[model samples]
Target chain A: LEGCAPCGELAQRLAFLAEVDRLKSVLRASLLCDGSRRENSAEHSWHLALYALVMAPHARPAVEIGRVIRMLLIHDLVEIDTGDVPIHAQNGAAHHGTAQLQAEAEAAERIFGLLPAPQGVELRALWAEFEANETPDAVFAKSLDRAQPVMQNIASGGGTWAEYRVTYAQLVERVGLRIERGAPTLWHWLSESAQVYFTARTGG
Target chain B: LEGCAPCGELAQRLAFLAEVDRLKSVLRASLLCDGSRRENSAEHSWHLALYALVMAPHARPAVEIGRVIRMLLIHDLVEIDTGDVPIHAQNGAAHHGTAQLQAEAEAAERIFGLLPAPQGVELRALWAEFEANETPDAVFAKSLDRAQPVMQNIASGGGTWAEYRVTYAQLVERVGLRIERGAPTLWHWLSESAQVYFTARTGG
Candidate 1:
């Protein structure tokens, strides 16, 4: 029971949890496949974790699914502070440029800092790895993070693509290359669907 | 490149992903602590997974944090089929009787079955372990599944407790005991807050 004493560590953990609840309110540009409403960052993270778990076999060099899952779950917590920057919106990457990257790094510090030291450092590392997309696990995680919204857009009949008037070339250049790096199989399957989607849109 | 051929395995995996996207639409009994609206099962699953990550250190016997995270992520996928049955609601457990168990098992089968064989079997086994709540990992996972809503309720100044007219006695018996078994420290701290919350309401 002495160990169970009300402690600052517990309070810090709860504070972090409470702050992240804001993520459920931070909407992404992607729509639900059902076309219900825009998906939020929290559930999108959850879905991407699911993607990692199910799609681990598709990773070229293989990856530790657990590490990939960890990356997916916490990678977007920075969005709670910096808000979502959709990569497809006109100049969305431009918008997620140097200033946004700095803000996201600071947000990661403040948000993960809400936890006790060990846990905060571990999660901060995972976030940084996901951003780097250098390791096999991080690359696979980045693939899922990109793949999910593409699936949603295709399923919802050109969801954000339609709304943003994105072209096939932009979709391939901006999103397809990243997915190809980590998950060529997924990108291959999705590119076929994308080609059909855009071709139909142009009545080609 | 041969492995990147659009194959049946890819289709099956995508089907599973598309089907589970419905999970985001299924709402839960607990409101977001912000009181903006009810949280959906998908986001709740996401949040609980986040909880397992941050609170893994608190589990009494300690548990595999990765296994706990997977359990939390997929535990409520059954709710996509059966919908959420809030425990504090009158007859809630009664509603979760044999028939409901059967329905949930079937839901797990159909949903996880949408993935290729190895992945589906792996995920379905995880879901069953979560339901059994017998393993240390499952017990800690159950602790988080319970702790999250109680935290949400307390944070929102009795979010679900007020909504369901839950009494302290019922809270202690129904929720507190479960959390105590795996996360006694969390229960100790939360019970103190619950005491003050209920005491203030009763003017005791």
Candidate 2:
């Protein structure tokens, strides 16, 4: 831990890395695209970041790709402590509980604060931006975040949707609308494809 | 795939995302710190990018961190096609061969080329930069990349190194030098700790 400073920056960074490794254990409700097992927050965040990078052109043409990537990568680090609350479980009144919001905000500070000062500050800001979902970058990142589980559900033949008894109406209202707002083209393709999947599965 | 496009950028980007998901199946020699299973290239790249962001202060202060993170994220993506080559296997004369390098370069092109034009060009440039390892950003990224496996090996009770018959001398020569070159303090700690580990195991 000794490096020219009393509390080494390297030590702080290593602590942060070790702490975030716990994120790999926090399982999400969605399955991996392969359906081998439930996906973890670490892998989910990684996929979202890659999605942001590859799909940068889809995010409002003026969006900063770097900011979107950063937002995607850090969006779920708070879940390292709060754990993932599956969207299907958060219908209407359940989604807006003040207690859940307060806990996640505190978790964000404690988790991101493990890094050295400047790095911690930067990441917390990015996390906050994504939480707000007001910026184009945040909206785009959220779009991918919402779309990914739907893609996994469809890929795995109704993996989460079937397991949770999630209705097509809920999927459309919760996930599809956000995708449309952020990346209209992606929403169009995804919504149509997802509808076909639900229809085939449910005989709607 | 249909949308208003000066080009079909969104479709191309989505295709690239689906293509890169194959990286999740492309396993590497390093085990997760938990020793559950071999880590995939996607998660490894994600960890390295997060490492670069959190540990940037530990790199030579002059390093451009944004570039280092980008390099870390895309560095092993070529493995999506070429497959991972364990470090222990690349000893002395076996390390350098025209065929291996040529195959990887081709793999890089085909994988990165999956993105839309401008993004693909940028990523290809980033992947090439990491391969060259001359820039400060590349060196920092390479340092993290090398150190990660060592940390995992140590954490998992000599996992891959023990499995592959990797000697202390080989680890020092191949990994230690790079760590020393990029982040001397980490090299000092890791080399000392790793020497103790090898000595205990081999009585050398």
Candidate 3:
């Protein structure tokens, strides 16, 4: 709208690029389930983006890989304003769940709106699709994000394990859900790896 | 050029957004000379963006704030492949500098070129302008990015000081270069701050 009709797209492009860059500054995630040892928002997004690429072959019934890629990329932008809340820690958080989710939902809308209308709508839809987890592609993308780090943790002798003292049961529940939801093979391997490592551990 | 003229600037806009998103992931700075903690690329850019905004009044004469802002925003994209080579690390080990700078220059061209030709050209110009540090806008942008974090670290009790083992002497030299190049007033205050802090300890 700020530029000539022909230049409108260029204007929108510049504005959208600026918006996502701004969003990156706001996105943060904790390596631990607790608020400590947090990684910057950009690192989290990068991890997800890489998940989309490497894990693409493992998606469900198969869909547009590009669309699924888009879904994974925007899925976590909402963490910007709501600041990253550790989902696992919310088990007994009382009323914090609804408020936190609502804050994320609102932040998603505002950050997406930073783009011009059309792009804003497209990205918002991708984000929503990923959150709903009903679509095959979204399910796969979400599972990968949840599962890859679990794989890393197991590989690293339980990443964030010593820091947070994550238990076998708790870790299983967190990592096992992915197998049931998407990428059965990755989930299967992850479950087995966790089993072998958890049992072999000596005195904590 | 990938998109036909009729298709317009859509390709460029999408490309630019995608490129900036990737840059954020690649960035990792020690966040001070002392290497206290890592700062996300996005946060670094945000701080620099803020620097451009607040320091406009003190920018070199005839510098365009908009150009400077754009340059500072994307200046670090080159870091995607190069990673954040700290200033202190560069002091005596300048032998490998050309390859890294060349790689970044190419990365900038490829990333910014994703947009429409004109937009790509505009962005590349801005990126190179900041790197050259010859123009007033480039000099001012570079100076601001360097100077702000030094005082910020000092105020924060050498956030990076103890971590990275940065000395006041190094900060003075780095901060002083900015003053000599673009922002004399800011540099002067910082130099004086270093002197005061050092003298108090010296029993002067």
Best by lDDT: 1
Task: State candidate 3's DockQ.
Answer: 0.05
DockQ of candidate 2 against the true complex: 0.45
Judged by whole-model lDDT over C-alpha atoms, candidate 1 comes out at 0.87
lDDT of 2 by residue, A28-109 (tens): 9988777777888877788888887777666798788877877777788888788888887745345547988998999999
Q: lDDT at A146 for candidate 1?
A: 87
For A73-133, candidate 3 gives per-residue lDDT tens digits of 5666676566655535544242246777688779888887765577678778888888777
Residues B1-204 of candidate 1 have per-residue lDDT tens digits of 123335788888888888899999999889898888999999999999999988877876558888899888898998889898888877335545888899999999989987888989998999999889899999999888888898888778888888778889989888899899888998988898788789998889
TM-score of chain A of 2: 0.93
lDDT of 2 by residue, B49-117 (tens): 888777666789779877787777778878877888877775534444687788889998898787777
Q: Score the docking of each candidate (DockQ).
A: 0.61, 0.45, 0.05
Worst 10 residues of 3 chain A by lDDT: A27-36
- Between candidates 2 and 3, name the one with more favorable lDDT: 2
Cα lDDT tens digits, model 3, B33-55, are 33445566645665565456445
What does the interface RMSD come to for each candidate?
2.8, 2.0, 12.6
Q: Interface RMSD for candidate number 3?
A: 12.6
TM-score, per-candidate, Cα-based:
0.95, 0.88, 0.50
Q: Whose DockQ is greatest here? A: 1
